[model samples]
Target: MGLRLLIIVALFLVVEIYAYQAVRTLFKPKWLLISYALISLFLLVYIVYSFMQFDRAVGQTQHTMFVMGLMLLVYLPKIVITVILLGEDVFRLGASLVNYLMYNLPKNELMPERRKFVSQLALGLAAVPFLSLLYGIFEGKYNFKVIKQTVFFPDLPDAFDGFKITQISDVHSGSFDNHEKINYAIDLINDQETDMILFTGDIVNTHATEMHPWLNTFNRIKKYKYGKFAVLGNHDYGEYVTWPSQKAKDDNFKGIKNLYGQIGFDLLLNEHRFIEKDGQKLALVGVENWGKNFKQAGDLNKAALGVNQNDFKILMSHDPSHWEYEIKEHPKNFHLTFSGHTHGMQFGIEIPGVFKWSVAEYIYKQWAGLYENKGRYVYVNRGFGYHAYPGRVGIMPEITVIELKKGSNVG
Candidate 1:
């Protein structure tokens, strides 16, 4: 996760840096210098803290310093955004221009005469935490989103036109302390005129014991016709948390699987199930964590057992890389696959044309939207819940409704 975060922050800094460069000519480079210096300081602290976070055995010295460092960076955006919007839109805009400069260039002690900028820098840094707190408010309610694509197979019958499949992925159950906030998300999904509901992995975090409290919240989900199904994410097994005995870990996996069953979902561990209506069967194959970086234990060949290759198939794998690395080149092409590991770096622009260039581009070409490989379709969901960061800036929580239309050509 450290490497993942490093990649994400690096991506964010790249955009922020370039955005700063665009406005450099407009602001005093000295102000730009100070503002830039502030950003570098934050980034340096962030990098140090990040390293501290990744090194578990580094004792509290590095951990404490690192965490304290990250605590400030997390709030810097709020400060930047707030300062840019103060009193009037223009003044705030000016602040924003300055803030970008600060983030791009860390200007300190370079010039003896530029001492007046220190007050603005200090003031800006002071608002970081408050800005982050304000940013949290943006996540309180339902946000309208654009579903990038609707996949279709030639054999799909007309009965399933605009078939809405609400997909939620990366719900790290252990991360949630408040059930009401979770219910809000669930209510959002239930209220949608969705056809079937599918959760693509990470149903629970670690031991099954961590999931007992939130069963009621997840069970509140309601919708139109088809039932619910899910597969295992990388965190499903309790690997991060140490157990007294290996048996404890084994029992945790068992309990988590039972919890999945309890939540009214079919835990598809490298297996296929058919969702049929009006005598037309649509094959849905789900495999346990088949990511390029995470776990590669699931077998797509076994998942497709007894299911004919000619049938219209929709696969549910966790990460987008799986589709790129495995499914797209499989012997039998899956018409559509739903995945949600990207969460869109949880905070990058995903507006189709431009979203492709973001950091997510370097990793998964089809990070948080839809892509077609050869002729097959894959939808990378933007996740239902947030993780370690606890907030989303660009790629919001997604409630996907896939509309499947019958195609005349089945070849």
Candidate 2:
């Protein structure tokens, strides 16, 4: 922590000296000196918090603490914006970055080797913010994806083979301030050649009407022989946002569930339905939002309790962890499970048979994609929406088209 503090201090000193010199070159005001000192103080706190929490584990509760400490600096921006709006809005890191790129960058006095190193780091760091926005564009439309695993049920007849089920998770439609980008996303989903469309969870950021505008696009999406289906996600229930009364919140929740029906989706709540073709059956079971410290994962045990042991089953529960810890170990094994709450966080590496490590792994081993044990398969689709972070990085949104096939009893 001490070493990290030193590094932070050193970086701040370098940037401050450069900034002061640039400001003082023309004329230095006493207020400017005071402002710089305050900014330095804020940096001191931010850097110290970041350093102390730098080594915290991502899976444990400490992980959220780490993120909260870093975001402490982020919240100051809105306060700073309202109180002090002029001369680059120091708290708005984006503004400072633009200024640094456009001006102070050319003024570095370091040696050639040192100069190039700093230049590269500066450019790379600056890229993360813009790259986040680009992530939003691609993620909203479910582009740049990796297929985790394609599961096949041998019990399924040839008639249902190659039946592609498109899965979308975390739409967070209320987050769409950019209509064009959202429309593009809707167009992309509507254009897919999918048989069945399943929305695992999280249809809106809050209000049910938030999804009304997207209906035209969602309507265009080709439904399967079984039709479109959805289960509630943590967000869809409006727990994150506040209402004047519990009744209001419950009303909103029911409204969104009704919206799902209007959009041609059967909102599943701890229920099961069989998809039939050619005298064969594949039971698809869905549960309402539920999990540890998350939504009520609903009851997979009850949802599947009625299914015949011999019939193949597909379970759609939002959080992937449910599959890892609960369903996989259950007595009545599920042939395939589909989940999408992770969104791969809209960032990470999904290279097939390659390395996979991200914060999501800390909480959900089945974070994004397919994991199998025995004959049971869990396919965690990279989601189709963005959330609080507001943009994706390496992980793009996904429109999962899972084509279940028939495999031999032996591997």
Candidate 3:
């Protein structure tokens, strides 16, 4: 592990060196250059020290989050500069090789001087992410976008033809620093006035106490006619931290489950509830966090015990990977599944309808938005809050409002 860490640090230093070449080419003042290097060195040392000080028992905290934000803000742009400058080096190497082979140039003078325009271009490109990350930390995390999606199900219960369900997932309440913004987001959800509200969870980072301050804030969410419901997320299980004992972990898990009820939500734990409208019943089945890479505590069969395969069902599971790996192919034939956990990797370019891309796409097939497989659909909410990085980039936080329609075609 020590060797691996050393290798990673070495690579990080190499990227910094390559990135600095861009700055050196563009600037000539020695004092200014020395100041930049000193600042970079200080940040690198502090970041490494902070990471080394991280306590697994304590898990994520404001201090750690700040360090993570700093690490990303410092390195991501540098990586961009590194890649660009490295490409220039490759080209320069080829030119030097040709000069040596064809013109018999001396080895000492074989390589040509680096182009100023190339450095300028690299720095210009690097500025994009640097500014974006800064904006993300200060504002984008709270940039809540209401995404309305109307899904058509041929077998949708007739009485619930135009049912509107608002979903907010991956709350990660522990990471919230602005109550005013959260209240505004809550108001936005209330303004929708959807028939039902579903939260596919991560109510806290690792400890239930992380959500205590936000209790009344979240409690402000008005009750929906059909009711508000939620299911446990992987984080709610407190799996990320090292517990003193299993009982302590169990106690925290119990507290996390109670947080939903405190917020006026009926916490569903491998259970199902039927919402009846005009003599027609639609099944709402919820399972505990069942992630392909995380936990497998959710029991789908147990949750859907009373509901038949033909029943119109909407399943709420925390991780989208659950739907992709197991539920999608399950015989239960859930009409729709709501999930969050990917958070669109909290970074990616998403141009609605025209183009969408995230690093998360490589991991989960249904990373964001609505995805369908043989009439069964899953809508993955980008997230309601930010986590590790403490901010969002291109993919803004989401409040997904889905309307259920009875038809073969989706609008």
Candidate 4:
């Protein structure tokens, strides 16, 4: 903790210095300087106060929201200024070296002071991201988008051809601040009107009480013909918080599972349920939370107990890493897998076919959208809600509608 604080302070000082240089270079008026100083001092105080109260504020949605806004609006702009200025310094150093080598310039004459235009340019570039983040907080956070995809499978049952499944994941209810916006999101899911609904976990951040407030809103979600099913994510296990006793923790877990029931979802814990249509059965398997570094309570084999080897199977696992590490090459040959833990890091550039990238891609091989290997498939939902970051940027919250088509060459 001490080391982390030192690093944060050091970074803050560097960023502020760069910000000061940029502002001072552009404007020399005493009034302007005084205004800048006061703004900087207030931001610095807020940053320190946020850090000092982090432990107490983290669990409180409103407090954390304020801190996150400060980070995006103030701290992020300073960091961007620092990066732009650092890049400018690198070019300046190269210019100095070139002057010495080519013209045999004296030490005093070799290097010139940073250009005022360079500082102006740095500040200008930094404003782009700062303004974008501000917009993200206000609008992008609630910008729920529906991503439609079609996956073809040779082994898919003809009776279930063109079966539409709506998927949502990572509803960290603890972090939600707006009830009306959440209700709007739920209404959007109902608008899809898919045959089945799959929730790939993280219903709450840590405890069951977080979900109590949203119960009525979620319970109003329109029922699907095939039914709604869900699996636990790492956050659902209450492992991130301290408990007074083991029984208290157990009680919390029970409440979380019961909340799913209240919301009209069948909670699957290493279990399999058959969704039948026209006398043809497609197995839906769901396993508990399992990730490379997170909780690994999920048992795929147990979930597949009654499922046949050739049955058209859909597995609901929280983390995409589970598909990367276990499910993709498993003997069972799950036709389609749904996951939602990535949330695309809630920030990234995703322009369909043109470009798709996120910091989460480095961590989870199958971070978001559809991934195929041989004949198997997995659709990773970006998530239904935001988490620690409070708001999303380029990667908006997602509601995935997958239409499963039978046979090849069917576009």
The 0-to-1 C-alpha lDDT of every candidate, in the order given, reads 0.68, 0.67, 0.94, 0.88
Please give each candidate's TM-score: 0.70, 0.69, 0.99, 0.94
Q: Which stretches of candidate 4 lie above 4 Å from their native place?
A: 56-60, 94-110
The full ranking of all candidates by TM-score, starting with the best, is: 3, 4, 1, 2
Choose the strongest candidate by lDDT.
Answer: 3
lDDT of 2 by residue, 176-234 (tens): 55566656666666666767788898888677877897777666666666778888888
TM-score of 1: 0.70
lDDT of 2: 0.67
* Deviation in Å, model 4, residue 58 alpha carbon: 6.6
Candidate 1 per-residue lDDT over residues 298-402, each given as its tens digit: 789999998887887889998878888889888888888889877676555555465344466777777877777667888888877655555565567777877
Best by TM-score: 3
Clashing pairs in 2: 152-405, 195-224, 289-296, 290-295, 290-296, 290-297, 291-297, 347-395
**Which run of 10 residues does model 3 get worst, by summed lDDT?**
14-23
Better of 3 and 4 by TM-score: 3
| Clashes within 3 Å, all models in order | 11, 8, 0, 0
